[model samples]
Target: MTTADYIALALFLALWALYSWLTAGSGSRFFPRLSLNRAMAERRRNWIYNSLRRDLKMIDTQILAGLQNGTAFFASTSIFAIGGCFALLGSTDKVEDVFSNLPFVYYGGRTAFELKVAGLTVLFGYSFFKFGWAYRLFNYCTILFGALPMMHDTNADRAKAEIAADQVIQMNTIAAGHFNAGLRALFLSIGYLGWFAGPYMFMAMTAIVVFVLTRRQYFSDARLALMDPVSDTKDKQERDMRT
Candidate 1:
């Protein structure tokens, strides 16, 4: 591969590693600290006293059920994606040959090359579809959060209910994070396939995409609002006082 391609590949790997490091922690790091145990405990206590005093057991059951469902969905989708990537290795040569021929192609005498291309294409298609659907499901979870019943009874002690709600939200957020991580893995696998052309180009494109995703997650307004320490601390303090 050319020098440019090598440079790109190096950059991509570096950025990917960096992004992983930056997002590794849920507290004192990353944009969202909502899952920090102390914060969650405070919210749970407030919710319990304010809205779930009578139905605490029921709320706990529902929260556990939601967590199980979300975790299962993510795990199944990720397994499918990994299987698809492994299947593609069997088709690499066919893909390489096809690309080599370019605009007008002839398989010549290479049956193995043809088979490899077909396999890689199928695998890539499966990965793309799985990743796309997982993303849609994650978006649906966000909508589910919005649809949760809001407590309107000012005099009702709702500490338990609030805690249940917080747990549900936290579980959903964790599921969404996992879904994104799966997508990242799929894309990285695809980029690795590009290494057949040469490691340099593979690294370059990977780096560029990684940089874009990191910037969006860390610098975007959505991330800022969620991660804002001042606001988050205030909310935690108020909830603690109420509890």
Candidate 2:
């Protein structure tokens, strides 16, 4: 490919790395606010601790099932995406011809096209592994949840019960982290598709994707919804009074 294409790809990867770092809590020292993922991780810990208080944990089991099912779904999707990339590679000659004929398209020739497809396949494969491992971790978390002491046992020795709950919380949070990693790869793949057009388009699309992800992580309505209810209500009332 050209120097511009290489530079664009490097920028795309750098932005992806930076965004992942920020969302993974590396930016906590610089910012007081929590990212959506971090906020949900706290909720997961609370849910696990709360489960220790209940004898019948059918709801907790169901939540674990849901997490496993969602991870499985994304893992399967990643596999399908990998297959699609291979299929595209198979038809690259025709696709290259079409791309070359398209106005404003860079069409970096056959080798470049194949290289792009190969990169996409690797990305999907990586995501599939992340999701697959996350699913297994969720399964382990479910078993750990079941092993947690009943309310009476917890009353007898709250410290021991809390330790067990903490184990489950850690497992669940690790699974969620891997699941988020897979999901992030899938989102970045959208920007990767822009590389088919040109390097400039690729960088632009990557920037746009990163901006959207940053907003959701640090400033979206979903993040706000997860904030403490009392504080949220107070802030809302003050704003309303001012208006």
Candidate 3:
């Protein structure tokens, strides 16, 4: 690959890192709004703690089950994606022939095509690992959730109950974080596929992917719906978009 190709790849990587940082770890409270996922994380904490004082925890258990199941589903999908990348690698000759015959195609030749396929393989590998880890973390979080005190115990001792609930919250949040990361990698891989077209195409498509992802995280209607524009104090309410 030429320097332009390398530069394009670097740009994609840089944008991914920057977006990850921007949306990660709950973000700043007052400047940028909390990412929609992180806003849900706050709700996750509330849900777990609120369950502590309730006699029945079926709802909370069902929520955790859904999280674990979702994680597992994505993990399985990532495996299939990794397999598809390998399938592409094996069919590079046919792919090269197809690209060569297309008048508008970039057709960077066999070596470049191989490299592009390799990059895709790497992307799916990263996604698979993230999803696998997220699934395990979700399982661990479920265990932690189960360890939480029952209503009788929590009623008798609120502090211990709060601490246990906090543990569940942290574990659940971390699992969700890894799940988000895996999903991000999957989305970016779609842009990486553009590399087979040419470096410029790669860079352009990656930017579009990043834009869409960031918009969903920070500015989408779902985010606005989850957020409250009114804070407790009048001045603080004007400053913060969360209640």
Considering every candidate listed, which one attains the maximal lDDT?
2
Name the lDDT value of residue 160 in candidate 1.
44
In every candidate, how many clashes are there?
A: 30, 0, 0
| Candidate 2 per-residue C-alpha lDDT over 1-243 given as tens digits, one digit per residue, 9 for 90 to 100 | 999889988998899899888888997887756799999999998999888878999999999999999999999999999999999988988897799889988888999989988988988998999999999999999889889998999999999999999999999999999999999999999999999998999999999999999989977777776778576675355445545
Candidate whose TM-score is highest:
2
In candidate 1, where is summed lDDT lowest over 10 consecutive residues? 33-42
TM-score of each: 0.46, 0.95, 0.91
Q: Rate the local accuracy (lDDT) of all candidates.
A: 0.51, 0.90, 0.83
Ranking by lDDT: 2, 3, 1
Model 3, range 46-78, lDDT digits (tens) per residue? 788788877787888798789888878888888
lDDT of 1 by residue, 133-182 (tens): 55555455445444344454322545644654565455445554554555
Q: What's the TM for model 3?
A: 0.91
